[model samples]
Target: MGSIDRYIFRTTLASFALVLVSLTGVIWITQALRGIDLMTSQGQTILTFLGVTSLVIPALVLVISPIALMIAISHTLNKLATDSEIIVMNAAGFSPFRLFRPFIYATCVVAVLVAFIAAYLAPDGMRRIKQWDAEITADVLTNILQPGRFAQLDQNLTIRIRERQPGGLLVGIFIDDRRDPKERVSIVADHGTVVKNEGGSFLILEDGNLERFEIDKRDPALVAFARYGFDMSKFSNQGHDVALGIRERYLWELISPPDDDPVYLQLPGQFRAELHDRFMSPIYPFAFAALTFAFLGAPRTTRQSRNFSIGSSILAVFGLRMAGFACSVMAVKSPFAPIVQYLMLLLAIGVSLWIIIGGIVIEPPASLIESINNANARLLRLFGRPATA
Candidate 1:
């Protein structure tokens, strides 16, 4: 690569990284805020909370990277135009396609990243997070049951703890079980720890007294014990499987879902849609780069206004993405939707390539430009400042 190519390549990639990180961080913070209950209500430590929430970053980056590449391209192009570098290069016989080579190189780099995240990293993160969340929820006695508050572990069973100490120790424990119609049981204990083994979850209570009241008898039977094991097998998910959602499936899983998979059988259309979406994810960076270059790559005189070109670039990028989203949604119901989306993307890239290759300078009509100038001048006069023609 020549010096100019390397310079442009480095600049665009640096800008892409900056914009990608900034946007991903901002969006991740918003998403992490929604999971703050993990720490506040679930009594999870900050490390656990952040670790679980940070897994969503790959997914966020999968969506943000294409847009970041477009922004970086636009910034680089504008910088070149501002310094008259593009005009000088053109005068020296550099074609539009030549100027675009470095941008495409940078786009390819970002496209690979987006593809990796979409195909594997994002889904893996989602799957791990779901499993982690299930594990946390399964440890109900330690995580969900808070101190000084009565927790309804089951429909007719309530448990309370006065103080929760380190090492899974629950001090001043109380339990009221009315699950059976023929009997009611109440228990109070000085301390307890939850234990799980192959036999299942058990709450081992120490220094506890149990009272059982039978329906046939008015008086209750009371028994004091030094240690007792209360069955809590129902609260544990160790006996069951964790069902994964469509988004949690990897690309290969989506492509060749097992015939007996329950989620696939129930929502096969979603699986199809998601598979196509992942396939299309990497293509968007190329499409966005094409549109950006088509709008802003042309060399223009200093007298020309680039405001219209910039606006058009934004609109084009947004329109393409919104169309892609709509198609992905419709693909869940209609098989033709994916085809239409492919055609749409191809047409966008085709037209953009045509413009770039043909050196077509995109600009508004002269009458519209004149009207905008007049409006600006009038506003300037109102502000007591003269406007340039």
Candidate 2:
């Protein structure tokens, strides 16, 4: 690469990195908020909250990288145009394709990043998130250890602890259970402790009394007990052996799922769609960079502004991306639908290359420019200023 190529490559890569991080951080906060309950209500630590939330960053990057690349290329080209660097380079015998080579290099770099994340990092992160969630749900003590707050462990079960002392002692424990249709049970205990073993977890209550109310009877039956064990195993097994979603599976797994896999066997189209989507994801950065450069990187006269070109590029990129998304969705219903995604990407790349190599300059139509000028003149006249001729 020449010195000019290196300069543009560095500027574009830096801008892409900055935009990628900014966008991912903003989006991560929104997504992480949904998991805040793990800290606020579930008595989990801040580190735990961050760890679980950070696992989704790889997936977010996979989605945001291509958009960031487009923005970065546009910004770099705009800067060059505004500074007259592009005009100077063009006059110095630089072709549009030559000017775009640095951006192509940057795009290749981003494509590799996307490919790594899509094929490996994203799936691994999702798997970790799933495992973390399962562990959290199975940790019955974490769910019920919040003192002075009623922890709803199940739809019909709630537990509250007044205070917790060192050495695993709990004081003033209250339990409510209405899971049974025929009766409701409430237990008041002076002290309690949780015990776990191979059999499962148990909430052992001491110096407590149980009150049982039959649905048919008005009066309640009461029984006093010196020691009682309430089965807490049910909470741990609530979502046992849940199947992993398609997004959580590795790329190879998606391509060749086991015949016994229930989801793939039942909905084969989904697996097919996912397989193609993963393979096609890395191609977007190259296509997006090419399209943006073709639309905005060509040299234009000093009298022309590239605002229209910028807008057109944005619209075209958005349309192409949305079409790919739609194709993925359609592929879930029809096995042949994912072919459209490839076709659209290929068309974008091919058309953009043709335009760039052919020295095509995208400019606003004369009629539109005239209309804008006339509107500005009328506004100036209304404001008591002379209209430009």
Candidate 3:
């Protein structure tokens, strides 16, 4: 690569990084806000909240990278044109196709990034988030046993603690179980902690007394004990099997999901759609770059209307992406939909490359341009502002 190639490559990559980070951060903040209950309602640390929420970033990047690449390419091209660098290069025998090589290099870098995230990192992050949520929910003592409040674990059962201390210690523990119609049981303990092992989760209470009231008997039977193990496995998520969603499955798993897998058996179409979407994720950057350069890469003087070209480029890219999105959605029900997406992408790239290679300068017709200028002048006159000569 020459010095010019290096210069353009570095500039575009730097701009891509800045735009990607900025867009991802802003979007992540909006998404992370929805999970604020992890800190407020659930007894969790700030670090845990941030760590769990940050896992969604890989997915966000996968979606944002192509858009950022398009923006970077547009910015680089506009800058060159604004400074007359593109015009100078064209005069010096540098064709538009030759000038596009550096942009392709930068696009390749972003495409690789998108592919990695879509293939592994994004799904891995989603899997980790699911696991994190499972772990948090399985810790019933921390989630359900809020200090100084009675938590109705079930319609017929309630538990409360006067204070929750460090190291999973519970002070002034109380339990009311009325699940049995034949009996009403209440247990009060000075202190206790939740214990989980192969057997199941248990609320092991020390220095507690239990009083059991029989439906037939007037008086209650009281039993005082030094320690007791209260079965809480039902309330805890231990030993329960959970099915991972489509997003939580890795790429390989999606490709060859188990025949007996319940989610696969139920929503095979969705899995198919997801697989194609992931496969197409990396191609977007190249397609976007092609479309942008086709519309805006031609050497033109400042006197020519570039704003209309820029708008057309933006609209074209947006329409292409929207079509892709529609294809992905339709692929869920129709197997042929993925093929249409591929055709659309190929058609866009083919036409764009043809224009770039042919040195085609795309612009609105002179009459259309004149009409828009006259309309602008009329608006200016109506607003009592002088129109430009």
Candidate 4:
């Protein structure tokens, strides 16, 4: 690349990085909040919370990188135009395609990043997150170890512990079971420990008394035991492997799912749509950057600002992306729905490239511009201020 290309590429890269990080961080905090209960209520440490929550960043980056690149390109081009750099380049015989080369380079870089995340990193992260969540659910001690809080394992089962000792002992354990419609059982134990085995998990309580009462009868039967084994297999999610969702599967797996897989047989359209979506995701960055450049890369000598062009570009990008998303959603039901995504993207790239090469200037309609100017004049008059045409 030439020096000018390097300079523009670096500027766009810096802006893109800034916008990507800022947007991703803001969104990550909101998403991470949903997992905070793992630490606050489940007794997980801060590191565990951070580790589990950070896995979603790859997916977020894959979704937001294209939008961030578009914004960065628009910002860079606007800065150049405001300073008349683009006019100088045009006067020096620089074609619009020549000026856009640096942006295309940046788009290629972002496209590769998106492709990697979509094809590998995102699925791996999702799989890891699922495994972590399953492990957390299996660690029953973490859920019930929180003192003074009732942990509901099921709709009719609740457990509370008064305190936890250093030696993996639970003190002052209380269990309420109302799962049976005809009876209710309550148990209080002075000390207990959770034991896991091939059979299942069991809560072994020592020096505890159990009270059972029938729903129809007022009388209760009570029994005391020095040691009691309570089956807790139902409350724990261990030993059962979780099935990976379509999004959690690798690209190869999506392309060739096992014939015996019920999910594949039942929802073949969804699998096909996912495969197409992953392949098409990387091309969006280039399309968006090209569209932005076509709208704002050309030099204009008009005294009026380019706010209309900027807004139009933003609206066009948003509409095209939304259509692509809709296409993906519909592709889950109809096999041919993903074709719309390809058409939308290709059309955008083609139209933008044609406009850039033909040196066409896209401006708002004169009537609309005049209407806006007249409205601004009226508002200024109402405020007793002068308005400039």
List, residue by residue over 175-224, the lDDT tens digit for candidate 2. Answer: 99999989999999999876778888788999999999998999999999
Which of candidates 1 and 4 reaches a greater lDDT?
1
Per-candidate TM vs. native?
0.84, 0.80, 0.84, 0.80
Error of 4 at 337 (Å): 1.6
- What lDDT is reached at residue 171 by model 2? 85
Model 2 steric clash pairs: none
lDDT by residue (tens digit), candidate 3, 1-389 = 99999999999999999999999999999999999877766646788889999999999999999999999999999999999999999999999999999999999999999988988999999988988888676567768788899999889999999986544578899999999999999999999977889988899999999999999999999999999999988877876655689998888898999989989989989999999999899889999999999999999997776898889889999999999999999999999999999999989999999999999999998899899989998888889756699
What TM-score does candidate 2 get on C-alpha atoms? 0.80
Worst 10 residues of 1 by lDDT: 37-46
Off by over 4 Å in 4: 143-160, 163-239, 385-389
Worst 10 residues of 4 by lDDT: 136-145
By summed lDDT, which 10 consecutive residues of candidate 3 come out lowest? Answer: 36-45
Candidate 1: regions farther than 4 A off: 142-158, 163-172, 175-234, 377-389
Instruction: Report clash pairs, candidate 3.
Output: none
Candidate 2 overall lDDT versus native: 0.90
